[model samples]
Target: MFAAIIAAGVCSCYYDSEEGLYPSISSTCDTTNVTYSGKVVPIFANNCLSCHSNARAASSGGSVALENFADVSAQAASISAAINQTGPLSPMPKNGSKLKACLITTFDIWVRNGKPNN
Candidate 1:
């Protein structure tokens, strides 16, 4: 019985905010090049879409279909605002962790750089 319980617990999924952020931030993303092809799409794939993508039957928020680059390009500002919004009901990934500081910095740089397509 104890072995079965331990097996069940080990197989269950959990989100680790730090694991998702700092290493991915440094390795895969460059703030200087925050384009749809790079920074934003990957972040959405790894974090947001598990809950927000249309592929999930339980997805919320109007089929935000973030499975591709074009979707992200068109929705950049809205995405940015949602990520940065502060209040009782801001719509982010809804993790216990606040969006990582480096992640926010990268988004700001991306916006400042004309929201490029690179």
Candidate 2:
């Protein structure tokens, strides 16, 4: 019975934080080229577009469209807070693992750089 219980516990899926999975990601992350078109967009494309895209926002992403420069720039402050899982904003990638530290840092830098459209 103990063996069976242990097996079940070990096999069950649990939420994995980035720190638990890839501690090295923070040190190696390249935060120097965080452009709206290049770095920021790709992050949203991978992690957010399914819900936050213009076409799907109404149905799934609370109408928060991040597919364009104006919308994203407008929401940049909240985006930073949400990704860091802090402030009044809800932690993002909602119901999923936290974003890697590097990605969070990159996004924060973009937001701090005046959220430029470039």
Alpha-carbon local distance difference test for all models:
0.64, 0.82
lDDT of 1 at 32: 55
Clashing residue pairs, backbone N/CA/C < 3 A, model 1: none
Clashes of each: 0, 0
Best-fitting candidate, scored by lDDT: 2
TM-score of 2: 0.75
Tens-place lDDT digits, model 2, residues 56-92: 9999999899899898888888888888897888789
Candidate 2 clashes between residue pairs 3 or more apart in a chain or in different chains: none
Q: Which ranges in model 1 have alpha carbons more than 4 Å from their true place?
A: 1-30, 87-89
The stretch of ten residues in a row with the least summed lDDT in candidate 2 is 13-22
For model 1, residues 6-62, the per-residue Cα lDDT tens digits are 977755632344343344466454455566667766667766787667676255645
Q: Output the TM-score of candidate 1.
A: 0.57
Give per-model TM-scores: 0.57, 0.75
